[model samples]
Target chain A: MSLQEVFRNCAEQRRSALIGYLPAGFPTVSESVGLFEAMVRGDGHTPGCDIVEVGLPYSDPVMDGSTIQSAAERALRNGFRVRQLFDVVSAVAASGAVPVVMSYWNPIHRYGPDAFARDLRAAGGAGLITPDLVPEEAGEWMEASEEHRLDRIFLVAPSSTEHRLALTASAGTGFLYAASVMGVTGARESVSDSARELVRRTRAHTELPIGVGLGVRTAEHAAEVASFADGVIVGSAFVTRAEREGQDGVCAFAGELGRGVRTASPEPAGG
Target chain B: MTARDLGGAADPDELGSPDSGSHDPDEGGHFGPYGGRFMPEALIAAQDELAAEYDKARRDPEFVAELDRLLRDYAGRPSPLTEAERFSAHAGGARVLLKREDLNHTGSHKINNVLGQALLVKRMGKRRVIAETGAGQHGVATATACALLDLDCVIYMGATDTRRQALNVARMRLLGAEVRPVSTGSATLKDAINEALRDWVTNVADTHYLLGTAAGAHPFPLLVRNLHRVIGTEARQQVLERTGGLPDAVLACVGGGSNAIGIFHGFIDDPGVRLIGAEAGGHGLDSGEHGAALTSGSPGTLHGARSYLLQDEDGQIAEAYSISAGLDYPGVGPEHAWLADSGRAEYRAVTDEEAMEAFRLLSRTEGIIPAVESAHALAAALRVGTELGPEAVLVVNVSGRGDKDMDTAAHYFGLVPEAGITGEDQQ
Candidate 1:
């Protein structure tokens, strides 16, 4: 199903979906696909994950944390290229779960806009998440993505002004990524209550479903955040979980997190 | 502005006049095809932009004027042509002239290239500069240029190097450049280069990738070498005033090969003078540890340019090992590879022990503690002196000062004798 349909159902049900981010080509070139598959679909041999983000590792990813950076280097050494990233997306799309490409515009720009769009479409990519691409300059990519039927996800943060929030909401499709914290991506222990309010405010800005992410952990944090946003994109913890429980731990974490989102109370009446 | 300029995919010849390199137009940047812009379809535009702009900038009067102004006022140019009487005395009573590039403001010859590139950055309307550094020297030089120009700057370094050379990290931060520790493969200078290339590829429109040496992709080797040619150019004229004639030989160490090429260019056709490139042999050539690419490597493409690379049996570039971070790359500058083949410049390697011995010898004898990279050249001079029986005069390019190497040297010599920051130690 389209992420929009999934989002609509998510909104009606008052729950969130899981979006797990992993650096593309991590561990090794050959292992990345299998690892990704395990995270998205349980093969009895692998763990079933929800939405996935495959990061196109750049030479200099200034905003990323250590885990993602190491993952990128391993991927690069394993012969991962801009075009190769699309191939991974194609392989995942064939299996069922949507694949999201998380990258900075430099790689996209370095890869060229037209070729980048074409490859993303050819791979049946569900969407894109470029944290560095501001909404003011997002229209071109948005239009191109729409032409290819790819969801161009935009990030909404507490620091985003009202004008920017509205503009970004209009430009984005499929989902609006609501950051649960104020800093760069990393494994954090907790998020502030203001994150929940930001998600609520973001809901008022667009009919689009919102995914509250960044620093959201714990069943309580997930349940509380699920009360407002359509989804909770937990990246670092799953990466941490994968590191901790290996493949087994990742499966359990994703499976349990998916269940937690579904059973959590959607109403802010917890107040 | 795009990758199309880097490879110039279709008519790549259009990227340069072929003459932009020291190659003939018919050859198309071919040092017998071992040198040309052999890159992916993604890098063409960036290379093309740099090529076109660099051509104009090289000849522009204002660019030249600005470089001159900085070299004079900011960097303290016309660095003396000091006569190394004591160091040369035993060799046959013939004098040795030292081009004091070490005396430049940033403590090395790096400032010359950095100043020129910084001026070009301003002229091109770029507001930020990014570079990769192995040793903090290039980062410091690049940061100095950015600060002087008031441009935002960022430096990428390998995570491993950050611990190895924490002082450079602190120095870069003081210069207002953000020192980003890259956690990529082995986290050394090459990874830093990869990261810096990524940054420039992403932010090509308004950012200049200030390359540290005469290596890497097209235009960089050529451009950096041309800027540093000033070192040899000034020294040549100064030496003429003091001696009334050209010296018998000119020698310098070759890593990315800039310092050698810069000094050599001034005398490429000088039949009266011999040119020598001293490469790092690390431990020794037989033991497979060295930075002497032209001496020990085969011709191959690397960093967007063709050059001699230390490669494995499968033809893949091998990891080069050098005690000197500045000389640890697997490839040599393209021109150096050409010069080696043409037999115009003699190439030799100085073992790590030999270089360190020379490093101490120069310190104790001449009171100049040279960088390991520069010590290679001095070691070569000692070899030349022994051969010529004290009658042959030689001029050595003292490319950098030794202050930065004290910590590394002190530690290596057990001068500090402190067991710290490795293995079982934690601070």
Candidate 2:
């Protein structure tokens, strides 16, 4: 199913979608695929993950925290390549979970954007989540994504001005990624109070789903974010758990986080 | 996930033709396929602001005049072109002239870029400046500029570098700058840069990232190179007056390629002058421990720009090693990659041993102690001099002095005596 369908289904149930991220070929190609599959296979009552963001690792992950950096380093050391990302995406898609690629722009640019987009679509990827690429400089990527009928997801930070928010909302599709904090990706002690305001401001521009990421670590944090956001995006936390205790750890943590999104006490509307 | 067919549909060539030869970067900060603003979303506004201010500053007469005054009076511009006569004996009787950047204030060519950026920070009304250092020369220079401008300064350095170049760390601290040692991802120049960039994104509002080299994202390579262009402009005239014409070749070491590009700009339009950049060869290119990005690496992006970098098949950056901390970087400036690809310049790798030999030779023969980084260029010049013979004239950018590298040099050469040895006996 497309990412838009996933979000629509979650909204119909009055719950936010649970999105999980894992870098392709982390630890090993087969193991990372297995971990992602586990995340998507929910506890039967509620889906474990409504969507999956398979990370295409790059040499310098400036936006990533230490956990993701180490995970990507291991993936790179194991000879992970762009083709492996397609392999992971194909598997997740086959499992009936929507797969989107989270990547820095360089690898795609190096691999040719049009070819990457075409190949990614064939592999059944729903869209792309480019963390480092802003809409202002995403002309080439926009053209490629449009030609391939792939969603172009862009990040909107709390620091974004109104004009930037409007531009990002217009350029993005599938969902607008809201980075809840000003820092790099990692679990934090507290979610920034500014995130609510950012989401409200972004809503003024477009009706697209806004998924908040960066520092959303625990189930409590997930539920708190789910109260307002259309999706609760968890990345480094899962990778951190996976590093400590393999696939089983990811499965257990994802189940708990999935429950958190489904059982969240929605805040009073318009508050 | 099953592996799909290795289809011909994914043609690498479909990425299209290579970038055309352009002297300056395009609007998006690309130098051919090399440089661009590959950064997170938060810093886009800041980068745009910097690019805009740099555009205005470059055109403003008052800004130009003030910068010129500072370069002349404060940083001691018009550095001399000294002929290394005694040193020429080992160079097969070739005439070698040194562009004495080592004589500049703070003892390195980093002063030029630091002063210019520091001036910009003041103009931008930013009260704080942050920087990254490898050998600590840039950090020292940044600290000096911040002190002069009364701006708050913080420098990030690799923990290993902080230990090796402890004296330089102390120098920066004494100049009232806070020195933070980074201990991540190989704990070297590249790691320090990562930490600095993180700091920039977090504190971009009140802090200006004073990038030291002619690399990184847009405006930086252009701004830093233009700031140090005087090195070439002065050397060009000095060499012309001394030899009555341009030299056959110009050589400088490439560590982020600041000094090399600075000197090369003077002779780039004069096609006859062969521009050669000396990269750190470490043990050797075959040893898998070198910073010879142009010679051994493929096109990839790191830091903020696409350039030649030492990376694995998976595009993960590989660790680079060199005796000189300054030259031990995995990536080269995008413009250098462009020049190498366009056949405008040639690059070679000089082994650590070769650089050390030149380091000692220059001190003993010419009474000039060159930084280990500059010695890489001197080492390459030795071979080039022999190839061109006695009639050839060559100019080498002595980018920095050896004071900061004294500990490394002393350790490498065993200049420090044992603790128990008496002074009289040592003599």
Candidate 3:
């Protein structure tokens, strides 16, 4: 299914979409595929995650915290290549979840954006979420994504001005990634107060789904974010859980977060 | 005479070709195929603002006058170009000259870049400055400048470097800057940069990220090179007056390629003068434990710019090792990569053993102790000198003093006493 379809389905169900992230080839290539499969299909309790963001590991993950950095390091050490990202994506997409790629821009540039977008689309991937690429420098990627009919997701940070927020919202297609904190990606104890304000400001520019990420760690945090956001994106938390609990741990944790998104009281329209 | 008078005109672009415009980075911050603004959405505006401000500051007469005054009165500019006669006998009898950047305030050419950026921070109305350092020379310089300007300063150093260069860490603290030790990602220069970038993004409103070297994103490579261009300009005129002509070769150590680019700028348009850069060949290129990015690396992007980098087959950046902390980086400045690829400069790798020998040779022969980083250039000079013969005139940029490298030098040479320690503890 397309990323838009996934969000439409979540909106129909009166629940925010649950998006889980895992670096492809972490621990091992085959094991990461298994972990991703678990993230898509829950333990027969709540609905499985709505979307999966397969991380294409880069050498310097400047936006990542230690958890994701170590995971990426392990993945890179285990001979994770960009081609292996397709394998992970194909498996996750086969399980009926939208698989989007979250990568730094250099790998795509180095790997050739057109070829990467073509290969990813052929592998049933939905789109790309470039953490470090802004709208101004994304012309090449935008053309490639357009050629492949892939969604180009861009980020809107809490530090973004209204002008920047508008520019990003217009440039983005799949969903607008709203960073919940001003710092690098980590599971913080409390979400910044600015996140909600940022989401509100971004909503003034576009009607597209806004997914909140970077600091959401627990079911409670996910539920809190889901009260307002259209999607709840969890990355380092899933990687950390998968590190300790394996695939079953990923399912249990993702299931709980999925339940949280379902149980949260949605905010009033335009509130 | 004032120090500025000894250096001729202070116009940075005057020494280079007016028609070529070779020194300026293109509008997109690219130097040929290397360098661009590969950054997050949050930093595009900041980077653009910096690039614009730097463009204005470079052309502003008042800004130039103020910076020239600081370079003269505050940071001790017009550092001497000394003729190393005694040391020349070992370099195949070549006439060797040393650009004495070690004589500058804070004991390194880093002062040149630091003062320029600190002045820009003040001009931007930012009250706080943050920086990342590996060997702590850049950190010390930044802290010194911040203290002089009364700007709040925070320096990030890798946990490993903080321990290895504890004296420098103390010096930074004494300069009233907060030192934060980053314990992530190989615990080195790259990690410190990551931490500093994080700080900059988080505190973009009131802080300026004072990047030390010529590597990182846009405006930095151009800004840093311009700030330190005086090294090459002064050395060029001094060499001309001393030798009646340009040297056959100009050599400097290349980590992030700041010192080398600084010295190379004056002679870049002069096709006759060979520009040589010596990189750290930690153990040896064959041993796979080295930081010879230009010699052993491929074109890749790291730390926000496309540059030659040591990486694995899958494009993961590999850890670079060198006895000199400053030279132990996996990536080179994008402009250096451009220079190497364009045939404007030649780069060679000098092994740790060779650099140490050069370090010892310079001290014993000329009574001048060189930083281990600079010793790489000295080792390269020895080879290039022998190849060029006795009539060759060469200028080597002594990028920093060896005072901060005593521990490493003592450890390398076994200069410690029976107690396995040196200094006041023995006294």
Estimate every model's Cα lDDT from 0 to 1: 0.73, 0.87, 0.88
Query: What's the DockQ for every one of the candidates?
Result: 0.04, 0.42, 0.51
TM-score of 3: 0.92
Q: Model 2, range A44-163, lDDT digits (tens) per residue?
A: 555688899999987677888788988887888788888788989999998778999999976887788899999999999999999888775687899999999999999998778888
Off by over 4 Å in 2: A26-31, A42-45, A74-83, A109-119, A135-148, A161-163, A243-249, A263-271, B1-22, B418-427
The TM-score of candidate 3's chain A against the true chain A comes to: 0.98
Give TM per candidate. Answer: 0.63, 0.90, 0.92
Which of candidates 1 and 3 is the stronger one according to DockQ?
3
Error of 1 at A259 (Å): 23
Candidate 2 lDDT over B229-282, as tens digits, reads 778878888999998999999999998999999899878879899999999999
Q: By DockQ, highest first, what's the ranking?
A: 3, 2, 1
**Candidate 1 lDDT tens digits, B324-389:** 777777788887887788888899998887777778777876888777888889888888877776
Q: List TM-score (chain A only) for every prediction.
A: 0.90, 0.97, 0.98
The candidate that achieves the highest lDDT relative to the unseen native structure: 3
Best by the DockQ measure: 3
- Model 3 segments more than 4 A misplaced: A76-82, A109-114, A161-163, A203-208, A263-271, B1-22, B418-427
